[model samples]
Target: MDHAPQLIQERSAPPATLVIFGASGDLTRRKLLPAVDNLARHGRLPDQFALVGVARTPMSDEQFAESALGGKSLLDKRQLAGGVRYVAGGYDDPETYKRLAETLDELDAVRGTSGNRLFYLSTPAGAFEPVINGLAGAGLNQATETSFARLVIEKPYGRDLATARELDGVVHGAFEEHQVFRIDHYLGKDTVQNVLALRFANSIFQPIWDRSWIDHVQITVAETLGVGTRGGFYEGAGAMRDIVQNHVLQVLALALMEPPVSFEGENLRNEKVKLLQAIRLPTDRDVSEAAVRGQYTRGGTREELMAGYREEVGVDPLSRTETYAAMRLNVDNWRWAGVPFYVRTGKRLPARLTEVALQFQRPPHLPIPADQLTELDADALILRIQPNEGISLRFGAKVPGHSFRVRTASMNFSYDQTFVEESPEAYERLLLDALIGDASLFIRSDEVQQSWRIVDPIIEHWERDRSPIPSYEAASWGPTDADRLIGRNGRKWRNAS
Candidate 1:
């Protein structure tokens, strides 16, 4: 018999003031504000909480609140909107820091926030150092005897290994490692978090999760939209830095990490760091064979004509930047010593999808005749991360009736159908976690450097090679070279079409 789901109550976050660095930007409106509103609706916010917005745009407190609310009524319209305050100033200006410090002190006294603060760096990557230094110079980085202070940084953490290390130094200088929260929204997704629960919370799958039973693992994050107006940023980042380095690699670490002693912040983060460190760093020759890069060209229906990446506004007419990337990574560890993990991400693909798939080895002996079992294939377990969040298992099943024939069949689980409540947005979970001082889903400094180390060789090799990169049609899967990358190992990418 089926049982009703248990309801777990979450504690409200302690009183604090959330100071957003890029409060005037699109991300603040589209994601940050909406997330905070959602948290209030869910009763996850404290009565003494306050919000402060800091940006160069000049606006009064009332004006900032109006702009943030966007003419929509919120669950806690009075508390949410009335608590907002704004400070307009340049990130690098010490005067700006002076105003910010004064604003924070006023809020702490008026709102009973107790000096607790969560500084969110929603600004561009270039502004990180200035913001960190600004907070320190203003004495905002220190926690009082009865209070706490923390920093939440957005990604594109660094362009490469050396830069990542340099940025780490700057951040560490102002904030201790424990007070820093390096956020990747992908880690906050319910589906992504379920990966750990699916393996550790369940005993049925743990014993066979290693090299002996699993043939390979595939992690994909695909997007159907082109660069649009962000072509300038895309050129500098490309697929590797923008997606693979942080999102894709973080998901891979979570899916493969050994079980933590407990799901606490330190234990979970330590396991992920170890898993990332185990990823084998590819060599010059390995990069040539295992990494494939491609750009998207003009190809779509006549009614919906698409422009090639090179033709996008702000992009070089002959840009060599990659819109697509696929790679085969090997983890040199005891459990996964001989297993391969394939990862790929791209823009202008067939669909917007993100998933992790594990293919199990075929049965040693199928007693059925080969011809009758022609439809049989290796079993697979797929964890879908977006679009349609779910888990699916594919295995052989008897084709009804005569001849003992078999074919692939699936058993599925959908979050929408199974859960009574809707899952919160990624930003909501991340923000709340940061406020409550939980770093389990946040990335650690060692994890960032180690991930960069794994992909640095391939990025360097690509930069040195000036040859034209392969191109795929706008509505297609990817370049033919990507197929050959996995084909060399007698495997193929999962057909998401």
Candidate 2:
């Protein structure tokens, strides 16, 4: 059997018109445009392709194309003359939608492009409903005999379960289930997909990837930047809603999911939703003991100094937002029962990183020295999701020139060293996936509701109590309580790079 790691399989590109709702927004210019450019550069787009950028501001197609493709690298830029256009309209403005609908025809006439359109809801959450209604009103959401129409929504699906359900109603009213792409970019990451490959592609891991051999799992996404320019947005959406609700939860589900019947896209997503559903809600006692919410205060480490969240632009001075959250979660099923899954995510910490650590159970038969137990920590399977995308395994190894002293050493599988190519960014991957009608990376409607159900109670508890969220230093892991929450279990977060 070949023990080689595999890359995400590339498939045929579909010819479709791409539309961006918030064309002037940062996400559109920074991610959407660049991703499209990359797709074009890779020769993945069809000759009949077109892009329609819709926003509240009116700008010429040349102006909009220049704005969208302005700072993109040369490798990402491609020739798309007469293949892109801009349609200015408010999210709730019916007239704007009509104009955009008309522009689709104009693009088709000029480029012989099909009527196929993928509408990316690049606008903020508040505008989601209005845009959906606007599409419906403008008759742009209909699937004609000649073409397909798809709607792609950005993350932060909702503030809670109720809002999510409400948003679901608004979106479902305008488009069918398959046409609505609820994208969670994390799923598009080459490394995230590799999690499946690392387990299934290798025979060494599957048999031992259970509660019997695995001690605990930790998924962390730490960011060094504070609220910054997104203070207004971050204030309303703390770390929990902003990151954990979708990104962290998706990562957790992927980590905990059982091996799917097949490695196909939808099959993987079906398994993911099941794993997510298996997560037991935090009880009152669990919340009191296992959950931690923290805010970053004014302090500095030896390396760098930083301001508190309140000091950021657009943030309320008396902001009650949480920059850090740590919780002990569990899957009530037999596979993960009794094994605590510790998940922590934060902003304005020591670094910007994302990783999933699977700590395997200690050896049932220990022949090593008793004093070396700390060094004999569980065999660890570490998958770095960002900074460096790779997999590392840690196991007990004999110390150099020593008696029987054993230490853990990492055997790594670095993607860059092996593949020698940059993994396409998440947006590019997801965009290409959407164009090909792959709904695997996007969230299923039910999955969105289930995530909200799990998080709804925590939000309710925080709202009712108005408790004082603990503060941590700018360049520290998090509050002291967050450490203790894990320490009491006799386990600590591994020192990660």
Best by TM-score: 1
Assess the local accuracy of residue 480 in candidate 2 as a C-alpha lDDT between 0 and 100.
Answer: 88
TM-score for each of the candidates: 0.97, 0.94
Candidate 1 off by > 4 Å: 1-7
lDDT (10s digit) by residue, model 2, range 258-376: 88888666798788888888998986556867678998888785466678877889988887888899888889887889889888999878878899999988777887669865676
What is the model-wide C-alpha lDDT for candidate 2?
Answer: 0.84
Give per-residue CA lDDT, model 1, range 347-413, as digits (tens). Answer: 8999999999999999988788888888877899999999799999999999999778999999999
Going through the candidates in the order shown, the clash numbers are 0, 0
User: What is the lDDT, from 0 to 100, of the residue 368 in candidate 1?
Assistant: 87
How far residue 163's Cα lies from its native spot in candidate 1, in Å, is 0.7
